[model samples]
Target: MSGLKLEQVVKRYGATQVIHGVDLTIEDGEFCVFVGPSGCGKSTLLRMVAGLEDTSDGKISIGGRDVTRLDPAERGVAMVFQTYALYPHMTVAENMGFGLKMTGHPKAEVKAKVDEAARVLKLGDYLDRKPKALSGGQRQRVAIGRAIVRGPEVFLFDEPLSNLDAELRVEMRVEIARLHQEIGATMIYVTHDQVEAMTLADKIVVLRAGRVEQVGAPLDLYNDPDNRFVAGFIGSPAMNFFDGTLHKGGLRVPGLGDVTMAAPRNAAGAVTVGLRPNHLFLAEGDSHVVELSEQLGGVSYHYLKASDGTKLIVEAHDQSAPKPGSRTGLRIDPAKAFFFNAENGLRLR
Candidate 1:
């Protein structure tokens, strides 16, 4: 296991820059996840670390070794991509030991390593089965086992679960998390799913448009985001935003029945008020109309539209669900509200 560091890491294609200067550090044995929307350069940046994409500028180091210009094989990193990319003709054991065999490792040595990897991944029973005979999740485990046999310093996973079905995705997530804990390897995972990021990462690096938006533990980012984008992107169902005017006295938001509340210190003028779905509750009165309601057993989601046409979603824990087109009111928790500058989207301290 080893730590990885990126100093002003950058990537470009001709004159078009896809990744800007990004500085980050992943401590040894940390499960770090790079999360962002599509086209945000998360994959591009991961490719750079793998030495598969040229770093237009900047430095990348793994285990205290400068590998900025090193070849992919020399970078001491094993990558598990979105595709399984396993050999259909080879048995699971052969597929997992292929890398070592190609490098002239003795047959016995390769078998031992493959055996250990299979044990760790719970694929011992499937060793003799070919890729065609394995399920999607098992095939992916074979792919991961292949990487493990190489014993690289770092593991890079680029949306490794995207191809799996919903149930398989969840199953694979637990498998990967367990693998990380058992091996204690330094792993960098890239994904657009915030739920995955929140559940899997020890630390998450949130990116946007090739720049670092924020980096912190999942719950830290969710509870205290530095800007509007991070706040919206880090949480599931996303945070709800309301346009409000901040004055010396308080803040007024028409979307919440023209509600007024105390403003943060030194905040004034046009600001965006953010509230999580769970923070907002349904109440009596007809300030808004329920556009839709989703009941998922233990919890329900109410989609509402204010009289002024502002849309919002409220999460409720009860079984009661309002009917569509029904009049309703929203209750906001002032203490849980977040304020950001409307123009710049920066948090108001």
Candidate 2:
């Protein structure tokens, strides 16, 4: 059982506390990701798990073995950092085998491990080349290969694709996913980009303000968010929120007029209505004006604003669409709508 477990983990830097009472579990061979905004302590938590940072409190166990006080070398974990801190002067083969060589492995043994890692990473052709000769994606693969050669029980990646170009990042995402399927090693990855979190993780831990907010599969988090923050942060272009006053017959929105809605149990007064951009559609009537249109080949996103200045994004699939600045009516499927409490941002349903 090479799984990871954390119990009431906390990290404090002098008088300020950064990570607070975090408890989590990463199952063996699971690809888990820690995602959040800057200064949210996602990286700090990952570093603590790596044994790079000391645990101020609480227990950490890997494979059911207590490793809270263990040094990084003794923890059976390998980390791939964001920066490709390769030795420019060393060939790919040498770079991959350097750690094993230093640890006094026989030359033949080191060579075998390096060779296998190279083959796994598709870096066999580049083994003789220096780091300077490789492209961004290749260098990253070399970094991963370096970690693989260590034969660690778990792999930790700290935003390893942040430095790559957009196209290369996508390419490397596929490479990493394939590597995980082939090796089936327990993995922990940290990143602020939700898109990366969505695409790469088998499980995602969403953190905010040094505390974990939610945990689930990617689509689970998207389709069934616990609160407004999780809903807004997990989706691209974000979920649109409109404030309104609830009445017996309908909800009164400031800019868009009253919308008839079935009231929830004990629901009344101030409230917030949540609508995903994809759920909104064009209708006949002139209640809203188009602000802009973003056409991305096959699909388009129309930005609209009501007379009272409430903004919305409506995703339109057809090429023939309303022109910018045109007035139109909008309709939402009530079944697709999400309701949230205006006071605390918690999902009402």
Candidate 3:
């Protein structure tokens, strides 16, 4: 029952308010991720839950116990930060057991806990190595092992993989995912990397300007977004958009031409058409011209612009991807099209 709940959470610094009233519930053993662009208050909200930042107004409960006013150590939560934060001179085992030692745990008990964590994190072979002797991923693992030795009810990670190289980031992502699956603990991870959010989270909390935009499972948010922001932010290449206005049965995009949308006619004023890059395909009509092609081995992405100059991206795996400045027709299944209100950037559904 180590779930977490936040009710009407708010944070303010003098007259400037951040982290608006946000209500969320993360069930026990759920891997929840907080993701958004920089300065979007994702980290701030996570810090608040960790008792590192004060909540201006709200109630925070972990395992049903109110912890908004409790000190960090008293809240029974362990946090792993972006920085490794390990003791430079101490061995891995010593670093992992330091907290328990400081709290006066018996040496044997500390060693036992440290040994268990090392086993879990696959750090048994490097237990005697100092922080300086480990690779970036290994150091981060040691940091995670340090947290595991504490046996906290919940684990908080703040951009734990931001420092790693691309390949290492992917490696560590899998490692963390496996760790969560093996331990089945309640975990909250924060990152600006959408790939990390998509792959690691059982659920995602997308924030903006200190307010929550959407919260749902990764693919749920990807396939069904609440707004333009959520649709655009959750994917890798991102969802493509074009400014349009309601016409007879669809919206008329100046550059993309007329597109039949599923939005209610009564809800229309100025509208936007959202087409995922993966959904667009090459057709035979002269609708667009290829602007650029990004080829990455087996897959390629063709950046195109309509005759009217509305830009779009099409995901193509064909080796003979369209060349730059080549004319081509693009089409999408009518059922897959997404519409948003141009004024508020909200989904038209």
Instruction: Summarize candidate 2's per-residue lDDT along 102-162 as a digit string, tens digits.
Output: 9999999999999999989999899999999999999999999999999998999999999
TM-score of each: 0.99, 0.97, 0.97
Point out the worst 10-residue segment of candidate 1 by lDDT. Answer: 261-270
lDDT tens per residue, model 3, 248-294: 76666665645545555556688788888888888887778888999
Estimate, for each residue in 136-235, the C-alpha lDDT of model 1 and write its tens digit: 9999999999999999999999999999999999999999999999999999999999999999999999999999999999999999999999999989
Error of 1 at 76 (Å): 0.5
RMSD of each: 0.8, 1.4, 1.4
Compare the candidates by lDDT and give the number of the best one. Answer: 1
Report residue 127 deviation for candidate 3 (angstroms): 0.5
Error of 1 at 305 (Å): 0.5
User: What value of lDDT does candidate 1 attain over all alpha carbons?
Assistant: 0.94
The C-alpha stretches of model 3 lying farther than 4 A from their native spots are 257-263
Q: What overall lDDT goes with each candidate model?
A: 0.94, 0.90, 0.91
- Estimate the overall C-alpha local distance difference test score of candidate 2: 0.90
Off by over 4 Å in 2: 255-257, 266-268
